[model samples]
Target: MSAASDIAKDHKLAVFPAFHRVADRKVVIAGGGDEAAAKIRLLSETSARLVVVAKTLSPASEAAVATSGAVWIDRLFAPDDLADAALAFAASGKEAADRAVVEAARAAGVPVNAVDRPEICDFYVGALVNRAPVAVAITSTGTGPVLARHIRAKIEAMLPGETGALARIAESLRETIASVFSNGTDRRRYWERFFSGSVADALKLRGEDAARRTAKELIGTREHTGRVTLVGAGPGAEDLLTLRAQRVLQEADVIVHDQLVPDAVIAMGRRDAERVAVGKAKGAHSVTQERINEILVERATRGERVVRLKSGDPMIFSRAGEEIAALEAAGIAYDIVPGVTAALAAASSAKIPLTLRGIASSVVFATGHDRHSNVLPDWANLALSGATVAVYMGRTVAGKVATRLMAAGLPATTPVAVVENAAHADERAFTGRLDDLPELSRRSDVDGAVLIVIGEAVGEAGANAAEPLAPLGALLEAA
Candidate 1:
């Protein structure tokens, strides 16, 4: 499968992830303490009619209730409190009080969450990442609530802040699109383009006015207008991909990717999307550049949303220029989505800075070899420019590069850091003097893509940095 498959077929869920429709419906919270206040804050974001029942209220609980405009019943929990309620929260803190609330909710056929009492609870509350109309709920089945929130934070970073606006726009255009495209296939394709093509791009970059104008141009058009997007896969790490790159991958009708792009990154694309591996590696040319360009033109001409997935930033040495030219020649529309380049990822993995205030003022990105597979012509000058040089795909010629740099008045003890398969779980980094770069690059264990960084700045490996961030999934046991 190109994307996630049906997990229910091979595994079972401890608690199914479901959204309860509580708009204008009563949602009871049988408490008036800190625990109930938390639930009140959460439910307040929804359109549900919140009702809090308790004999007494904490200062915080009273404030929350007042802010949420909830009906505060100044009485003890009872069975009638859950009457006509869609959902209930038994968050009274006291074991007996919580149990009483749970019993009442169960008798009323309402799903209930009993704070810190999972065994008796009918449902579990998950950490929510909201991009409204589009919400992501993450849970560890009550085993880890902290972990779920951490994951939600990570997802929140990955998703664009403007996604909710885009979703609202798409929702507004549904009927118009449905009426215009009568064929089911055409309807689905149009929506896909609406989400992944020029309209989506305009929305993201130019706001609703441009997005509406772009959509208006597409409305009622019978002919399918195909386009191509050059997406940077971002140094083999799935999380490193840009938000736009992820969107295009999920919406692509066909993904034409390189061999260096890992399976994890490729799996981000639509599951049913056609995958054409037209990758080019050393001594292997299963598909030439000319033919690859032809393929992009052909697919896009047929109204397919094509994603030309490349390793690292496509604009840098990915030969995106040739493809762009081909698309232009064919009069096809195209977009370019930048990615986290390998050089930047490699420096990050090695914990080194490419540019320092006094040590190094600039950084240069250079390929290890040219089209004919020869080391760069002026490799020595780049090394002697007093700037950090980040070399891509240069492992095979590391010896030649080191020799030339040393011969051109560059120091043999120049600091060098080499990272292979950067940002991946199996990533490895090596640091040494320029004299050792040849042996380090030639190591038998180096299998994946390699990036070589050379400069005095490589020696200053973020020694003054702050403490590292915590893992995304830390232990957080919550009911």
Candidate 2:
């Protein structure tokens, strides 16, 4: 076999992901242009000793080196320049010079990153989401840096700003905690409690001392009190979930979720926690509510943090009332974490305002299905209420809902929007008059959850729906 073919057969090319400890180490940069200046600014944030080698530097590079206190070598790059360096960067803006530096760095056993030249690069500098001790790096194997940066921006927004401070607090208390809890399992459990409990909250709100005190108190009393938290998983999309709901999921020792709750949302819970699916579908009840209540009570009473994860806002047609009552009657402590309900998510996805000042001053949320009885809610008053009506689980009975509204003096021409799998990747919205709802729902082919919005606000949305809203990333791109 040919040398290249033999090498390819023996080993596949792949970029191994890793974090190099460059603190107090030397990093050599051979360039005098904008690319070199950019690397200098990034390396300045770290504790690395930066050395810039260029016969002449541009104004930008000179200013950056001056501000960063990087050592300047006013001479041509030499092979010995890579000696004892942790890493090397070649952004000379000249192909010949960059290639020379890369060859020298490779000879010296140093990893080199050649800007805009992936073929010669030993390492590619990807996007960074710097939360200090909680830094996240994203890369695309030198195929697409822009794509990597976009992903980084999304993660940066999701991570709490206080994460670094919380990490610092944990580091300071690590020795004390280790001493207190000699067993490794007990130490891990204590740290999990610390991260999910009032210590982290105190760090966010009341600062370091209060958080320290809270941590100390937790150590003094290594007691586990079980509680049930009713969390809303939101409308399909994981990002639509509230921060409080995410935190509670991370802290859960047991997650009890419904069929309506998406798997992506359920996966956000602590990895080691037991997951029990007590989901209820339209006609099928895999697990009955009475049985579910028993499970919650049983788990919580056993000193396990139980999470009753419901789809969308738990308060809105999610049977949260029944569960809350059950917990209360059993004297099990519980709390509710609100989430972005289907109505809100549907409206946002369809670009429809639920309530407008002149068009719809109030909004009414109601369920299409009534499990207690076949009798529906008062349609006449709701039709006359001059409020936007957002119906949950209404796809099956869209025809009947339309008929009741029209019979109650609501115009057949009133605009309606049916949003299926709101805020999800497969989300689709159909806009038409109230009379068209049944047909629209039938043609939608949506097997997932569906929400219906009917009123003047929907009519206005249909009018201006042609204009697409700008994406959140547009601001970052503009910047």
Q: Which prediction has the highest TM-score against the true structure? A: 1
Question: RMSD to native for every prediction?
Answer: 8.6, 7.9
Candidate 1 Cα errors over 4 Å, as ranges:
1-10, 131-135, 154-182, 198-217, 372-374, 377-379, 438-448, 462-479
lDDT of 1 at 291: 95
TM-score of 2: 0.81
369-479, model 2: which lDDT tens digit per residue? Answer: 678644265754765677899988787788888888888889988888888788888887777777776664455346677888888888777343322112234325644
State the local distance difference test value for candidate 1. Answer: 0.85
Q: Between which residue pairs do clashes occur in model 2?
A: none
- Taken over the whole model, the C-alpha lDDT of each candidate is 0.85, 0.84
Q: Please list all clashing residue pairs in model 1, or write none if there are none.
A: 144-476
TM-score of each: 0.85, 0.81
Model 2 C-alpha lDDT versus the unseen true structure: 0.84
